[model samples]
Target chain A: MNHHPTEPQETIVTDMPDRPALLKRWRPRGAVWLAAPAVLVLLLALAYPLAIVVVRSFTDPAPGLDNYVWFFQSAVNRTVLQRTFVVAAWVTLVSLICAYPYAYAMTIVGRNLRLALILCVLVPFWLSGVVRTLAWVILLQDSGVINSFLRGLGLPPVKLIRTLPGVVIGMTQVLLPFMILPIYSVMKGIDTRLLQAARSLGAKPWRAFLQIYVPLSLPGVYAGAIIVFILSLGFYITPALLGGPRSILLSSLVQNQVLSLLNWGRGGAMGVVLLVATFVLLAIAAPLMRQKHSSTRREA
Target chain B: MRNFAGALALTMTCALALPVFAQETPVAGAVKEGSLEGKTLTFVSYGGIYQDGQVAALQEFVEKSGVTLLNDGPTEIAKLKAQVDAGNVTWDVVDTADLPPYVHCGTLFQKLDFSKLDVSKIPPGQVGECSVPAMNYGVIFMYKTETYKDNPPQNWVDFFDTEKFPGSRAIDGSGDPTGGLIEQAFKAAGGDPKAITPDDIEKGIQKLRDLGPDTIYWKTGAESQQLAESGEADMIMMWTGRAMTAAKNGAAYTPVWQDWLVVMDQMTIPVGVKDTDAAYALLNAYLGQRSQEILTEKTSYTPIHMDAKPQVDEITASFLTSTPERIAQGYQQNIPFWVENFDLAAEKWNALLSGN
Candidate 1:
């Protein structure tokens, strides 16, 4: 608000030091000391375990690159990897498509109504992942609720359990909250006046949304998609329960190797591959996120 | 500013030390200085009758030792690896599936000392280096007695002879990859289940593949029961307890114990536990004849103690697959064959299960 220039030169310069010293002066000594405990927790809880996995990946099971070789060359590993990415991509895209309208409705709706709808979405979110997945199984299994209803209506039951579509349905239901909340938060921040201005300029309602609202909401979409993808990549129970023989994701493969096969080396290697794939995806996403955000803002 | 720092320091101290402080209390001893009271000892186990059975069996231990048992369900190796990798080993005595210890033994599980307890109290050959048998159950054929009133599937061959017993069948699609069901099928097909050298596990898998689209693959015991109860499956390769429950609930199911693939869930102490003795005590308590009887009464599992006998009601007696006749027909999981051929068979099994 203060557009007018005050004294331009450093007339009232004190003995207080420059930028680095100013930062140093404000730094709380106690917080710096307290950071030790927090750092220690991070090391213990997160860093050490990850380091162990990395170390185990190398030295385990007679020590060599046999496990890693096995992972990449083996048909099972390749298939699991392929299946994991396929499932993750589908889950992310589906979640985004389903969540976008729901999120938009939440932002434009009244506060009380929005809260109620959000709570409805979040009730499943609050329910344990296993419980919700089990509910889906009850609903979707061949002789389950849905199929029974269909049968009652003299319709043949569709194969819902142990199929890719079933996996998608269960996973999307479990992950829909992660998608909706982020988009809603981003939508809330968008100024309605921008949409109004677009309309005033003779843009159709859908056109204004596409040109203005959609561009503004991209960051949240990106965030939600990344989260859903990460979560979907690591899905075990949903796929294990609902997914048929063909739907084994990488995590399940890692599980079978470790528990069923008892090959820590191979399992760890598979885990490392999974971790690396996730990291690579994240790496691509991070820079892309920055670029997309900058371009979108520039367009606005 | 000083007050904020003080509060911050206190909060950090509590946050960092609370888990340790809460878990350091000895189970059977007086609380030590700076020890946590009411330390939670997690038991990773399945729910339903099994969970109820475990609780019934461990009631005395809970009283004698002041350890709070936290029940986490079933064997999930991914979660275990995640927890171990995260350096937060939440499970103390995990009642897990048969093969997990072999996978995580020496790293995830503590090397058990059998010298202190009476291993003889266990069945002749059920003890492992890291784990002890929690209970014995099977993935066996269970048919609806009312549906197959003329004649039921007798054995593994009958299960495969679709032309003879033309109806939907359910089989386990989860758990161990190298299950004996397929091997038994191969054996019934005149392929030697015992001669299942690692090289032949593929043949066994092929035997399963031959079962083909007619087989409904049920993931959990509950799912298997659902398959049978809903009339989607006339017969199922089912967990004994699940079949018992289905039968009890008037689902018209009858277990065909012939060539049953019995797998034991063992209660083992994980590595990184500070109180091995307390864990052992719990294990010992779990093995006691009275406890075994109690577990049997509740769960329909044939508990390990040889002398343990429950006063079975007509319903319970009918469900008990451990009857001398049934026991004679059932074949134990070929653990020795599995152990020796684990590596090669494992690769082949994974390939097969993954449909490679």
Candidate 2:
């Protein structure tokens, strides 16, 4: 019914009459069977441990809510929790700022350069987080390379290691790829023709990019932010290695309680709180993300 | 079904034949061996060069006793507790801080069988009901020789005296606030280190805080060594072993042995270990003179055995804490006092570290 003018016409075939019969014969039993292994693995590996953690948070040392109470009551625990959120938020924002230009460059670059850029991101990805953190330590420590270079330039060496700034820089570097990849993937899917059309319609290049291209890339930014934010919240090694005593995070507190003090209930309670906070953040972000997506889809 | 039955019968025959194969007993007068035959024990220790030395030291035990030794850890006390609680205790023997075995004695660890162990060679006051001294070391004040060549800091009080020893100082911040830092702090505050009470801990913290922003902390032995090697701090309170390592790596630092805080690691048998007898045997072998000597030679940690004459190079000999003269000069850690007050001290320590 909607044939293109240049197309050669051919005899039409219809299987519509037999569609209901075929649909009636189809069963979901095979699909369910196929998914059974994955479901089992999720139950065993993820759900079981999570359930135990939740239970231990309530029951350990004695069957009471003492652990949760302690977490809320302790000024130190509360401060660390607040600090963790702040650090994660800062890392997410910084990653977003860095990743946007890198991803946009990836979208417009020649194939080889794009591949090279991707490799630059992925090479660090292949390295272990601890190795990357240690590399930062070597670069940022007082006698490390950066300070050495500053001294060589006849400049005073800046304090970098064992500081909040050092932790943020280390986290941002490690989490940059997590932010970039998602945004790049989405930006790659965005049609360039729309921006070109905006340009043709007498809009300037900057306006065309701002009005047309950026709206389409919002989904990628949101996805990347969510991923980076959640990951930064759970980060232990980078912050531990880079941050000073003042820069201690909730995960560090959890590690101290669980590993050093052997206070599992408190650690479990802290973990549960972190988990709930992450869920609450995602819950708040989800509807806003959905609204933006639907509006963008309507405009497209 | 027939094939299954045949396979089962073959397996049963092999099982029965195992004892028969071991029927050739050794001569009565020959060196008695294989006390731990057909047994496997997991030995846990803090990892890195120290653990490497431990494995090397225990090689003779593994060979002579015919026990298969599997190594694991950076020992976590929580993990040990969890394993014991779950009735699946996997770690047979654990090398741990001197305090934990004392604090959790009989609950987390078994009371060591003294009859099975020969503790004669171990230094006096080092052996406990539930643990044996694994190594002798110290948390000694080490300052950059270049910085203080004219007037070096001598004792704990000099370390805390920022005006006299002015540059940035690094102390043990790796946790366990009840360590030498507190002991030294107590001494610096005109309180005797031996007479330290939980109430005096706050005074110690105050004394340390008086050092102000000029003080830093290192959480790991490696970090302590790095601080010295990289010249981050003018003065560093470091473990003797790590100080030695940093010195060997060309850190221009000289140790101040006056009133050095003597510390030791303890070997423990975790409660509910699958084979208790084998664990004791392994512990016994670990404390042997040859084993201690090998440990000292390899790791630069001072040997526990008084008779262990470790063939150390000149550099290593200078750092060894087990020497009779050094031991006489060193201040022994009051283990029982620390053990009794660790939880209270740790809470206060954490709060202080957090700047709360």
Candidate 3:
């Protein structure tokens, strides 16, 4: 972290004595100007398209609430929407189960081993999503390696691909890094002496760790849960290839409406529904997250 | 007619499209070589082996015209609608195979200028208000040879009989080749294939869904071919175009060509095209006998031009939809039924796919 080589540049900036005066004059308003380009880009790319979709949901193919009525009336749409949330929740839960011990281990590992653990998470995490999902498809198919291995073990070949658990497994592998990194980062910051103090006060080892460390890790778990659940909701390709028709999600329904059915109004309405559902979930989650955030802050 | 001439003349001098209005116009896509230099046309289709053949068919035409040929899609009518609605129609010519947007009623596709095209040799009733028939492609049931070597499944009844010849099957889930698959399935379920009503759609989908739990529903022609190539399914209800390609590529499949169901996919200039003359020129070239020959040769989809006889290899020959023997049994598309109830069938098909 040494920056002795860059001291000359820092000295040069300080040598220009008017630099402080210039900074004092422009600091407040310069912040807004500096942020303007990013803010404008966000508005154009994100907000504008969203606005079009929301507007189209209401106004397209003759205005009214007909699209909403259509969406609600379709039993298939309701089923798919429910399936999407359920799959997302399952994926989040699966990732948590797989990631918690790995994250805890990472906190207790030596520096080199910790780096190795992170690399294991990152290399696959940075791989193309389509490629990764396709790899899972290869492993999980009926005549795939997993079934072959199971058959070799004198066990009946289990149905994994095109099932709900198959979707969760593929999603968990991709999302475990989200779970691991957050929990690991928070764990790394915790004071280990507190656990020792609990033990010194005659608390059992498991109880001390659970009562102290587990509460401290709640913020990270919540953050990871929020990310994995929200991201899983929007998943399209993995489920399409790896999951069967019974596991069809909301995104596929949206695609069916917009592309196949040529009903953009219905698609837009469906999209607006997804957006509203996500926002409502987020609104409920925000206060819970804030409360956890403040408790963590107080503990720190 | 005068407005067409005016529209044509807008591109160049008064003489450029003058002879286009004459009874003796130039042959389809016949132009002074390089006259269309710097011009562009975007060709859109249900891509895969078929689009590749189309691109090859247009090679000389594109080269001679010196027009920059831009390739685009796996076409969708909704995308065509969006392009037209936005008033920035990038796609010049689009090929729609499944569901043909017959209910679109000439809104998304232009009313093609028959004057500009060479439709003389094209079969009667093949020409529509907004488009020309691209090719005669059959959506037929093809089964893996080794899977059913004992006693081959013969007709739609045999196709739905899972207990007799049980193996995984792949069939069209999107549109179900509209009439062919559904009508056949309806008949297989003991309904009249000839007089298929909206009420028969559920019966058809029910028959399809009854194909057992081992069935996979394919959404695209390419996906169906992938099913063939991967040997992922024992039986596939797929296009002859894809079947031909798959067989040539070493897929072991034999079409149970009974009750041959033939359909001609249509080509159209989208409603708000950039250059009507240029777009028409591409369409004309694509419709020419030589281009049609190459297309039939490569894809085994029957040529629209009556005189274009393609010299296909044995594998391609077996899958050809327009054979005299096959055509004798061929059931042409029930377009009217589909034109009215395409959405209903699509919904039911999707519901069946969702395992409802």
> Pick by lDDT: which candidate is best?
2
For residues A1-300, could you state the per-residue lDDT of candidate 3 as single tens digits? 022112222332334777657868876755778878999999999999989998999988989999999989989999999899999999999999988899999989999998999899999989988889878877887767898899999999888877889988998888888888877776776677778988998989999888778877776777788889988999987887777778888998888878877888889999999989999988998898677655644543
Q: Using Cα atoms with residue i matched to residue i, what is each candidate's TM-score against the true structure? A: 0.77, 0.89, 0.87
Flag the better candidate by lDDT, 1 or 2: 2
Q: State residue B30's C-alpha deviation in candidate 3, in Å.
A: 3.5
Which ten contiguous residues of candidate 3 chain A have the minimum total lDDT? A1-10
- Order of the predicted models by DockQ, top scorer first: 2, 3, 1
Considering every candidate listed, which one attains the maximal TM-score?
Answer: 2
Candidate 1 has an lDDT of 0.74
B279: Cα error in model 1, Å? 8.3
Q: What share of the true interface contacts does candidate 2 keep?
A: 0.48
Q: Where in model 3 is the C-alpha error above 4 Å?
A: A1-33, B1-21, B46-49, B144-147, B174-177, B220-222, B248-253, B297-301
Alpha-carbon RMSD of each model:
13.0, 10.4, 7.1
Stretches of model 1 off by over 4 angstroms after superposition = A1-43, A285-291, B1-135, B144-151, B166-168, B177-179, B213-216, B263-291, B303-307
Chain A alone, TM-score per model? 0.86, 0.89, 0.87
